[model samples]
Target: MSDINVNHILNQMRSLSLQAAGKPVQETGGSTDFSSLLQQSLASVNETQQRAGRMVDAFESGASNISLAEVMVESQKANVSFQATLQVRNKLVEAYKDVMNMPM
Candidate 1:
Protein backbone atom coordinates (compact mmCIF):
# COMPACT_ATOMS: atom_id res chain seq x y z
CA MET A 1 0.00 0.00 0.00
CA SER A 2 1.38 3.37 -1.00
CA ASP A 3 0.98 5.91 1.79
CA ILE A 4 0.17 9.49 0.89
CA ASN A 5 1.83 12.17 2.95
CA VAL A 6 -0.89 14.48 4.27
CA ASN A 7 1.41 17.48 4.66
CA HIS A 8 2.69 17.17 1.09
CA ILE A 9 -0.87 16.91 -0.22
CA LEU A 10 -1.90 19.99 1.78
CA ASN A 11 1.13 21.95 0.57
CA GLN A 12 0.27 21.11 -3.04
CA MET A 13 -3.31 22.21 -2.37
CA ARG A 14 -2.11 25.54 -0.94
CA SER A 15 0.19 26.12 -3.89
CA LEU A 16 -2.67 25.41 -6.28
CA SER A 17 -4.90 27.79 -4.35
CA LEU A 18 -2.33 30.59 -4.58
CA GLN A 19 -2.14 30.02 -8.30
CA ALA A 20 -5.90 29.93 -8.58
CA ALA A 21 -6.50 33.21 -6.81
CA GLY A 22 -5.56 35.53 -9.67
CA LYS A 23 -1.99 34.24 -9.85
CA PRO A 24 -2.51 32.28 -13.09
CA VAL A 25 -2.56 28.48 -13.25
CA GLN A 26 0.47 27.65 -15.37
CA GLU A 27 0.30 31.32 -16.18
CA THR A 28 -3.04 30.60 -17.87
CA GLY A 29 -5.51 31.68 -15.12
CA GLY A 30 -7.86 30.32 -12.41
CA SER A 31 -9.55 30.87 -9.06
CA THR A 32 -10.45 28.67 -6.10
CA ASP A 33 -12.65 29.49 -3.13
CA PHE A 34 -10.83 28.95 0.12
CA SER A 35 -13.89 27.59 1.91
CA SER A 36 -14.49 24.96 -0.74
CA LEU A 37 -10.86 23.91 -0.66
CA LEU A 38 -11.06 23.56 3.09
CA GLN A 39 -14.25 21.54 2.85
CA GLN A 40 -12.67 19.18 0.38
CA SER A 41 -9.59 18.73 2.58
CA LEU A 42 -11.78 17.99 5.58
CA ALA A 43 -13.79 15.48 3.60
CA SER A 44 -10.63 13.79 2.43
CA VAL A 45 -9.37 13.47 5.96
CA ASN A 46 -12.67 12.09 7.16
CA GLU A 47 -12.76 9.56 4.34
CA THR A 48 -9.23 8.41 5.16
CA GLN A 49 -10.13 7.87 8.76
CA GLN A 50 -13.27 5.96 7.82
CA ARG A 51 -11.33 3.66 5.56
CA ALA A 52 -8.84 2.99 8.32
CA GLY A 53 -11.65 2.15 10.67
CA ARG A 54 -13.10 -0.30 8.20
CA MET A 55 -9.72 -1.93 7.79
CA VAL A 56 -9.43 -2.36 11.51
CA ASP A 57 -12.89 -3.84 11.76
CA ALA A 58 -12.13 -6.32 9.02
CA PHE A 59 -8.86 -7.37 10.64
CA GLU A 60 -10.52 -7.74 14.01
CA SER A 61 -13.16 -10.01 12.55
CA GLY A 62 -10.38 -12.34 11.39
CA ALA A 63 -10.37 -11.45 7.75
CA SER A 64 -7.62 -13.69 6.43
CA ASN A 65 -6.18 -11.31 3.88
CA ILE A 66 -6.00 -8.37 6.29
CA SER A 67 -2.73 -8.55 8.17
CA LEU A 68 -2.26 -7.07 11.64
CA ALA A 69 0.70 -5.07 10.39
CA GLU A 70 -1.38 -3.52 7.61
CA VAL A 71 -4.12 -2.61 10.04
CA MET A 72 -1.66 -0.96 12.40
CA VAL A 73 -0.03 1.04 9.63
CA GLU A 74 -3.34 2.28 8.22
CA SER A 75 -4.61 3.25 11.65
CA GLN A 76 -1.40 5.11 12.42
CA LYS A 77 -1.57 7.00 9.14
CA ALA A 78 -5.15 8.01 9.81
CA ASN A 79 -4.25 9.16 13.31
CA VAL A 80 -1.38 11.25 11.99
CA SER A 81 -3.57 12.83 9.33
CA PHE A 82 -6.23 13.76 11.89
CA GLN A 83 -3.55 15.25 14.13
CA ALA A 84 -2.22 17.31 11.25
CA THR A 85 -5.71 18.55 10.44
CA LEU A 86 -6.18 19.57 14.07
CA GLN A 87 -2.89 21.48 13.98
CA VAL A 88 -3.96 23.30 10.85
CA ARG A 89 -7.24 24.24 12.49
CA ASN A 90 -5.40 25.51 15.56
CA LYS A 91 -3.14 27.70 13.43
CA LEU A 92 -6.07 29.10 11.54
CA VAL A 93 -7.87 29.92 14.75
CA GLU A 94 -4.78 31.61 16.19
CA ALA A 95 -4.39 33.68 13.05
CA TYR A 96 -8.02 34.71 13.24
CA LYS A 97 -7.57 35.75 16.86
CA ASP A 98 -4.50 37.79 15.94
CA VAL A 99 -6.39 39.55 13.16
CA MET A 100 -9.35 40.28 15.42
CA ASN A 101 -7.08 41.75 18.04
CA MET A 102 -5.58 44.19 15.51
CA PRO A 103 -6.65 47.84 15.99
CA MET A 104 -8.97 49.34 13.45
Candidate 2:
Protein backbone atom coordinates (compact mmCIF):
# COMPACT_ATOMS: atom_id res chain seq x y z
CA MET A 1 0.00 0.00 0.00
CA SER A 2 1.14 3.55 -0.71
CA ASP A 3 1.12 6.40 1.80
CA ILE A 4 -1.71 8.92 1.55
CA ASN A 5 -0.82 12.61 1.91
CA VAL A 6 -1.96 13.80 5.33
CA ASN A 7 -1.98 17.42 4.23
CA HIS A 8 -4.21 16.66 1.26
CA ILE A 9 -6.69 14.82 3.43
CA LEU A 10 -6.73 17.62 5.99
CA ASN A 11 -7.32 20.24 3.29
CA GLN A 12 -10.16 18.27 1.76
CA MET A 13 -11.77 17.82 5.17
CA ARG A 14 -11.51 21.52 5.88
CA SER A 15 -13.11 22.37 2.55
CA LEU A 16 -16.00 20.02 3.27
CA SER A 17 -16.36 21.48 6.73
CA LEU A 18 -16.74 24.99 5.36
CA GLN A 19 -19.24 23.90 2.72
CA ALA A 20 -21.22 21.90 5.26
CA ALA A 21 -21.47 24.91 7.57
CA GLY A 22 -23.25 26.75 4.76
CA LYS A 23 -21.24 29.89 5.36
CA PRO A 24 -18.77 31.59 3.11
CA VAL A 25 -15.17 31.96 4.13
CA GLN A 26 -15.74 35.71 4.41
CA GLU A 27 -18.69 36.79 6.53
CA THR A 28 -20.77 39.62 5.04
CA GLY A 29 -20.79 41.57 8.32
CA GLY A 30 -24.38 40.58 8.89
CA SER A 31 -25.19 39.82 12.49
CA THR A 32 -26.11 36.18 13.08
CA ASP A 33 -27.89 35.07 16.24
CA PHE A 34 -26.58 32.26 18.41
CA SER A 35 -29.73 30.22 17.96
CA SER A 36 -29.60 30.36 14.16
CA LEU A 37 -25.92 29.60 14.03
CA LEU A 38 -26.34 26.65 16.34
CA GLN A 39 -29.26 25.38 14.32
CA GLN A 40 -27.33 25.65 11.08
CA SER A 41 -24.36 23.83 12.56
CA LEU A 42 -26.50 21.01 13.89
CA ALA A 43 -28.20 20.67 10.54
CA SER A 44 -24.85 20.47 8.83
CA VAL A 45 -23.67 17.73 11.17
CA ASN A 46 -26.84 15.76 10.63
CA GLU A 47 -26.46 16.07 6.87
CA THR A 48 -22.85 14.93 7.04
CA GLN A 49 -23.82 11.92 9.15
CA GLN A 50 -26.57 10.99 6.73
CA ARG A 51 -24.28 11.28 3.75
CA ALA A 52 -21.69 9.08 5.42
CA GLY A 53 -24.31 6.49 6.27
CA ARG A 54 -25.44 6.37 2.67
CA MET A 55 -21.88 6.03 1.48
CA VAL A 56 -21.31 3.14 3.87
CA ASP A 57 -24.44 1.38 2.66
CA ALA A 58 -23.45 1.81 -0.95
CA PHE A 59 -19.95 0.50 -0.36
CA GLU A 60 -21.19 -2.44 1.67
CA SER A 61 -23.50 -3.50 -1.18
CA GLY A 62 -20.52 -3.69 -3.51
CA ALA A 63 -20.75 -0.30 -5.12
CA SER A 64 -18.18 -0.06 -7.89
CA ASN A 65 -18.22 3.73 -7.87
CA ILE A 66 -17.60 4.16 -4.15
CA SER A 67 -14.00 3.76 -3.07
CA LEU A 68 -12.94 2.64 0.39
CA ALA A 69 -10.97 5.83 0.96
CA GLU A 70 -14.00 7.95 0.09
CA VAL A 71 -16.14 6.07 2.60
CA MET A 72 -13.44 6.36 5.26
CA VAL A 73 -13.03 10.10 4.76
CA GLU A 74 -16.76 10.65 4.94
CA SER A 75 -16.99 8.56 8.08
CA GLN A 76 -14.17 10.53 9.71
CA LYS A 77 -15.92 13.79 8.90
CA ALA A 78 -19.10 12.58 10.61
CA ASN A 79 -17.16 11.42 13.67
CA VAL A 80 -15.25 14.69 14.02
CA SER A 81 -18.41 16.76 13.73
CA PHE A 82 -20.16 14.55 16.29
CA GLN A 83 -17.29 14.78 18.72
CA ALA A 84 -17.24 18.55 18.41
CA THR A 85 -20.96 18.71 19.03
CA LEU A 86 -20.55 16.57 22.16
CA GLN A 87 -17.84 18.87 23.48
CA VAL A 88 -20.03 21.89 22.86
CA ARG A 89 -22.92 20.26 24.72
CA ASN A 90 -20.65 19.39 27.63
CA LYS A 91 -19.39 22.96 27.89
CA LEU A 92 -22.92 24.35 27.73
CA VAL A 93 -23.98 22.06 30.58
CA GLU A 94 -20.94 23.03 32.61
CA ALA A 95 -21.71 26.70 32.08
CA TYR A 96 -25.27 26.19 33.25
CA LYS A 97 -24.04 24.44 36.36
CA ASP A 98 -21.57 27.21 37.06
CA VAL A 99 -24.28 29.84 36.71
CA MET A 100 -26.58 27.98 39.01
CA ASN A 101 -23.83 27.50 41.60
CA MET A 102 -22.83 31.17 41.66
CA PRO A 103 -23.56 33.02 44.94
CA MET A 104 -26.75 35.01 44.82
Q: Which candidate leads the pack in TM-score?
A: 2
TM-score of each candidate structure, all chains considered together: 0.73, 0.74
Expressed as tens digits, the lDDT of each residue in 1-104 for candidate 2 is 77986656655665576776665653424444678758977898899899999999999999999999999999999999999999999999999999999999
For model 1, what is the alpha-carbon lDDT of residue 61? Answer: 92
Q: Please state the error at residue 99 of candidate 1 in Å.
A: 0.5
Give each model's whole-structure lDDT: 0.80, 0.84
**Mind giving the per-residue lDDT tens digits that candidate 1 earns over 34-100?**
7886896688679879999999999989999999899899899899879989999999999999999
lDDT of predicted model 2: 0.84
- Candidate 1 vs. true structure, TM-score: 0.73
Clashing pairs in 2: none
Most accurate candidate by lDDT:
2
Off by over 4 Å in 2: 1-30
Weakest ten-residue segment in model 1 by summed lDDT: 21-30
Compute the lDDT of residue 27 as modeled in candidate 1: 27
